[model samples]
Target: MTKLILICCLITALVIRINGHRSSIFAAAPAPSAPAAGDIVADTCKRAAAGDPDLDYNFCKSLLQSAPGSHKADLRGLAVISINLAKNNAQRVLGHIRNLIGEETNNTYRKECLKTCKEVYADAVGELKDSAKSIDSGRIHDARTALSASFDAAGTCEDSFSDGNIPSPLAADDDYYQNIGRIALSLAALLDN
Candidate 1:
C-alpha cells in the first residue's frame, strides 16, 4: 500500500510538471493596447491629405495588424487607406504623363488617353485629399462634396477604360479599374457619418 501511494504521488508530480511546461509554452503573450479609434482615423486622414503614400499605407497596415479579427471598423479603415494610396500614386503617374507629353516624341491618341487617365486620377486624388481635410476641419458637407467628386472621377475613368481602345496601363485590367471605383464608393459611404 505504501509503494502504491508512492507511485501515484510520483505520477501526479510528473503530470503536474508536464502541465506546467505545456502551459508555459502555450501561454498567450500580452496584447499591445489598441490605438484609439479617433486617433487612427485622424492619423490616416492626415497622412492621406499630406500626400504621403508610405505613411498612409503604414497607418492603415498598423490598424489591420492590431486587429486581424472581424473588426468591421478596421476593415473600413484599411479600405480607405488603400484607396487613398492608389489615388496618390495615380496622381504621381499623371505628373509623369505630363512630363512625357512635354519630352517624348511619340505623342498620339494612346498617349493622349494616358494623359487623360492621369488627369482623372489626379482629380480623384485631390477629391480624396479634400475630403480628408474637410473631415479634419469638421466640415461634414464639404467632405461629402469632395467624396462625390472623387467617386465621379473614378467612374469617369472606369467608363473611359471600358471603351476598350485606350492604350494605357489602366486598360490592362478591367477588374482593377472596377475595383478602384468600388473602393471610392465604399470610402465615400464609410466616411459619410
Candidate 2:
C-alpha cells in the first residue's frame, strides 16, 4: 500500500511539473511578427509619424500606395523607397526653380525668391543624395544629418519669401518638397530603431 501511494505521488508531481511547463510556454512573450506586405508601409508610416502633426496618415497611405514596390515591401524596403522619393522630389523641385529663375520678371522680390529657391533646391538635391548613400551604408547619424539638412533647405526656400514679405509663387512646390523630406526623415527614424 505504501509503494502504491509513493507511485501515485510521483505521478502527481510529474503531472504538476508538466502542466507548469506548458503554462510557461503559453505565458511567455510572443515573438515580434512582421506586418503583411500590403500593410507594412501604412503600419510603419503610422508608427513613425505618430508624433508629427504635419504628417497626415491618409496622405502618407496614398503616397505609399502609389509608390513602386510599396504594395509588397517590408520596412527596410519602405525606407529605401522613401529616400528615393526624397531624391526625386529634390531634383524635380530644382528643375522647377531653375525654370522659374529663367522666366522671372523684373520684380526684385520674385527674382530674389527664385534665386534663393534655386540655391536651396540645389543644396537639397545634393543632401538627399548624401542621405541615400548614408542610409545604404547603415550610417544612421550621417543619414539623419543629411535628411535634416534637406528638410531645412526646403524650409529656407519657403522662408525666403516669407521673410521678405513677398508671396511665394512656388508655395505648392515647396510644400511638396518639405513633405517629401518629412517622409524621408520618418523612414530614417524607423530604421534607426
Candidate 3:
C-alpha cells in the first residue's frame, strides 16, 4: 500500500514538473511597441521631405494625400503611391509634348526640338511605367533601374537643346519630370526595410 502511494505521488510530481516546463517554453514573448497611426504618416512624410530644400513636409504630405487610402499607407504603400504619381506625371507631360509638337508645325527648328523632346519624353514614360510596375510587385532593384533610366531620359531631353546651342522650351517640363522621378527613387530606396 505504501509503495502504491509512493508511485502515485511520483507520477503526480512528474506530471506537474512537465506541465510547468511546457508552460514556460510556450510562453509568449513581449511584443515590440508599434508606432501610432498618426505618427506613421507624419514620420513617413518627414523622412521623405528631409534633406531636400525643394521638398518640404507639406509637399510630401500633399503628395501622399493625393493617393487613395493615403491615411492608411505604410512605407511600402507610400513608395507605391509615389511611383504611381510619377507615372501620372509622365503621362501628362507626354500629352503636353504632343500638343506642343502640333502647335510648332510652322517653325522647323522648334518642330525638330519638340520632336526630339517627344522621343525622350516617350522613353521617360516607359521607364516610369516600368518602375511603377516593379515597385508594385516589390522588385526594388528593377524599380531603381527604371527610375534611373527615367532620370537619364529627362536629363537627355534637357541636354539635347544645350548641345545645339538652342534654348529648350521644355526645360520646365523636364525639370518637373526629373524632380518627381527623384522623389520616387528616394521612396523606392526606403523600401529595403
Candidate 4:
C-alpha cells in the first residue's frame, strides 16, 4: 500500500510539473507579427495621408506601389523607397536649377533666386543622405529629423522665389520632393511603433 501511495504521489508531482510548464507557455509574451506583405504600402500610405493633411493618399499609395520592389516591402523598405524618391527628385531639381542659372543671362532676379534655391537643394541632398543612413542604422528619430529638414528645404526653395517676387520654375519638383519626404517621415514613425 505504501508503494502504491508513492507511485500515486510521483504521478501527481509529474502532472503538477507539466501543468506548471503549460501555464508558463500560455503566459509567455507573443512574438510580434508583421503586417501582411500585400497591405503594407497601401496601409502605410493611408495612415500617413490621414496623419498629414498636406499628404495626398492616392499620390502616396501610387508612388510607393509603383516603385520597384515596393510591392513586397515592409515599413522600412517603404521608408527607404520614399527617401530615395525624394533624393532623386531633389537632385533633378538641383540640376534643373543649375541649367536655369546658366540660361538666365539677362534676368538677374530669377538667376539670384535660382542660386538661393540651388544652395537650399544642395543642402537638402546632403540632409537626405544623412536621413537614409539614420534609417538604415535603426535610428528613427534621427531619420525623421533629417527627413523633416529635407522637406523644409523644399519650402525654402519655394520661398526663395516667393521672397524675390519671382515665380518658381521648380514648383512641381518642390511639391514632389516635399510629398515624398512626408511619406518617408511617416514611415519612419511607423518603425517606432
- Best prediction by TM-score: 4
| Leading candidate by lDDT | 4
Residue 26 in model 4: lDDT: 40
What local distance difference test score does each model get? 0.54, 0.79, 0.75, 0.84
Q: Per-residue lDDT for 1-193 in model 3, tens only? A: 9999999778766876877643433346745677754565577767766745566576666666767876788787778777778778877877887888888757687777777778877887788788878878889999889888877866777777787788887788788777776667777877754
Q: Report the lDDT tens digits of candidate 4 across residue range 1-193.
A: 9999999778766776877653433445766686665587788898887777888888898888888999787788888888988898899989998999999989888888888889988999999889888988999899898888878878888898899887899989888887788888888887777
Residue-by-residue lDDT tens digits, candidate 2, 38-93: 68777877987795778777777777878988978776667777878878887888
What lDDT, from 0 to 1, does candidate 2 have?
0.79
For model 2, the stretches where C-alpha displacement exceeds 4 angstroms are 1-37
Give the clash count for model 3.
0
Which of the predicted structures, 2 or 4, would earn the higher lDDT when compared with the native? 4
Model 3 misplacement above 4 A: 1-39, 51-55
lDDT of 4: 0.84
Off by over 4 Å in 4: 1-38
Error of 2 at 14 (Å): 31
Candidate numbers sorted by lDDT from highest down: 4, 2, 3, 1
